[model samples]
Target: MAELTTSWLGMRLESPLVVAASPLSHDAEAIGAAVAAGAGAVVLYSLFEEDLTEELAAPRPSGAGLDPYLRQIEMLRQQVAVPVVASLNGTTPGGWTKYARSLEAAGASALELNLYEVAASPEHSGAELEFRQVDVVSAVVSAVEVPVTVKISPFYSSVPAFVRRLEEVGARGVTVFNRFYQPDISLDTLQVDRRVAPSTPAELPLRLHALALLSPFAKLSLGCSGGVHSGRDAAKAILCGAHVVQLASVLLERGPGYVGVMREELSGWLDSKKMVSCEGVRGKLGFGFTADAHAWERLNYTRTLHAGLPPGGGRPAGG
Candidate 1:
């Protein structure tokens, strides 16, 4: 059998399939099921700063506030042998250090700082926003002993430079992209409906492009998220140099046991390829490793557009 073991955020994972921060890991039973189903690691649902602030503003409820999140972390650590990564979703540097320290004390194996922020303020430049994010990461890193990884948004003007800044500030890893929830307009009511949409396999190419671009130069461990559904999808992530692949929608849609199915299929593919481990295929198709490094850039875009046109170099018959 091919070795499936890989490392992420300075911790050794038994497999590349990690459960992303989601409601599926809200309880010990669910976490146990995920571990039983072959998840290498589990990232608990995020503790949002806004939620924490709101809870704090309310009158005391006998230690029921942040205790739930902390309790979940402790319970998950006790329930599964794999690493239990605690996720903190916040934009600022102020209050995060406290919770990060608490999570470390709760026995979290590592921490994923989910920097899911939108720069809606005209006062802040892109550079200012990026620096603020880096400061937040630095504060959390200073507060926690456990490894810290940042789950970054894809809207950054320069991903590579930002990733380098993150690494310099002591982030052990960076998850490629964070899914931003967009609101839809209800045509009849003329109101905005905030709904969370599940990711599809089609989303993989975006993550693949980011991974391929950063894997060569990034010193931090690279993880791919957003549209990981099957064994093939996970394999593609590894090939593009992702140290690990995070899954949420698939597990929630198919149940935890599907992770085992993905594991088996991935192993089968690796065995057939005569590869010893995931590392063997890691970065095999990344920017620096590819014959045409420019393929991931604008050249590939132009080629794709030209290739799609008819032989006569005009639009198709439907046009």
Candidate 2:
């Protein structure tokens, strides 16, 4: 029989299909359904510091308090058979520490620190801005005993260095990127619309580069998020060196039952290749084992030389 189970951050999972933090994990019922639908693990909707502050700044009955969120997560973990991770995002060190510990105590198998802050302060330099994340990771790591994974944004001077700092600060895992919701312009009123959408398959190339950069670290479990659509995508991500594959936008669009589709596609691919388990095919094509690793890094420099007016413009002469 083909072995589908694997371990993520030391947590035993039935598959690599992790339900990335989304509204799909906001409540116990949703999580229970996901687990039933064959999710390897689940991440709760990120408890955003800014959103919580706004919620607490003024009392609102429509909002669920922190305790309720924790309780719901605890209830979720009990109802499911896979590892349940609670996600915490914050702007302040104290908030990260407090909430990380709270979630850990609430029966969360692990914690994901979404350390993303828009660097809008003019007084903050790049180094100074990143220092805040280092401090926050240190504080949160010290506060909780569970495995801590930091999901960071790609906006940085050096991604490899940033991931290294996170690992040095006791982070057990590093998720290279998170798909953030980009605002859209409404042509009618000329206003900003804040609805977040799911990612598509076109994003694989970018994620492949990130996985290549971080794979050499070896110790930290690297997870790739954004644009994972099928089992083929999952296999490609693993080949690129992602230990755990995070899925969200796709699940949101196709429903939790999508896990079965991914499983079918992945298993069929393995059968065609005569591979039995995910481990047999995992990281097989990674930079760790690749011959020409330049293909991932030489992207920008090579693209610059392609003499052409991209897409809607004129094609360049070669002959």
Candidate 3:
């Protein structure tokens, strides 16, 4: 039997499949079911900074505003033996330290900071934006004792450098690519409307590329999120050097019990390959392990384009 145990953010997990931050975790029963179904850990739905500010500004009864969110984390901690990771989504640097401390007090094993900021302003330079992000991470890390990880965006000018800065500020892990929902314009109202869409398998390659590129230089734990719907997808992520695979859409679509199915499939693949554990196969096909380091750059790009072309360089039979 292949061992599926893996470590992320200094916590040991029974498997690589993590319950990503989502509404499914809002219920205690659902959390227990996911753990029973083989989820290694559960990341509670995010507490947005905007929501926090609004609540705090109104000055409700003591602990009235934040009590519900904090109570959910406490309930999850008591219901399952696996680690419970708390998520905080914010764009600015202020007001996170206090929340981080509260989460740690609520028995959260780790914290995931979802820096879902869109650089829309003309005055904010990339360097200024990057510095603000790092400052927020540093403040939160200093405020909490538990392991801290950041859910990063793929829009960074230099991902590797930013990852290094995260490590410098004491982040223990980095989850690749937070999905930014693009808004659509409504023709009738002539106003922008929010649109939400689930990830498809096609998004896996982008996560894989980011993981492979950073695995060689980053010492922090790497998590692959987005488009992981099956064991095969998780396997590919592991091969690309992801310490854990985060799932949200698949669980919402198939229910929590599907985690067990994915676990069985992943275990079977490992057994057939004679791999002892997930750690053994991690980074096996990453940039550092591959024979052609530049294969991920443009080598495969040119090869794939030419592979479909004819000898005469004209249209093929289908065309």
Instruction: Highest lDDT: give the candidate number.
Output: 3
As for candidate 2, its clashing pairs are none
Q: How much lDDT does candidate 3 score? A: 0.89
For candidate 3, lDDT tens digit of each residue in 45-102? Answer: 8887777788767865643346788998888888899999999886555668878888
Worst 10 residues of 2 by lDDT: 310-319
Off by over 4 Å in 3: 58-65, 187-191, 290-296, 309-319
Cα-lDDT of candidate 1: 0.88
TM-scores for every predicted model:
0.93, 0.89, 0.91
Q: Write the per-residue lDDT of candidate 1 for residues 1-319, one digit (tens) a residue.
A: 9999998887889999999988888857877887888889999889887778888788556433578888888888877999999999874577789888888998999999999878899998999989989999999998888999999989999898899999999999999888999889999999999888888887898999899888888889999998999998999999988999999999889988899999998999999999999988998878976555665587888988878966766644665
lDDT (0-100) at residue 46 of candidate 2?
Answer: 85
Error in Å for residue 52 of model 3: 1.7
In angstroms, give how far residue 26 of model 1 lies from its true place. 0.4
Q: Give the candidate number with the greatest TM-score.
A: 1
| lDDT (C-alpha, whole model) for all candidates | 0.88, 0.80, 0.89
What are the runs in model 1 whose C-alpha is more than 4 Å off?
59-64, 290-296, 309-319
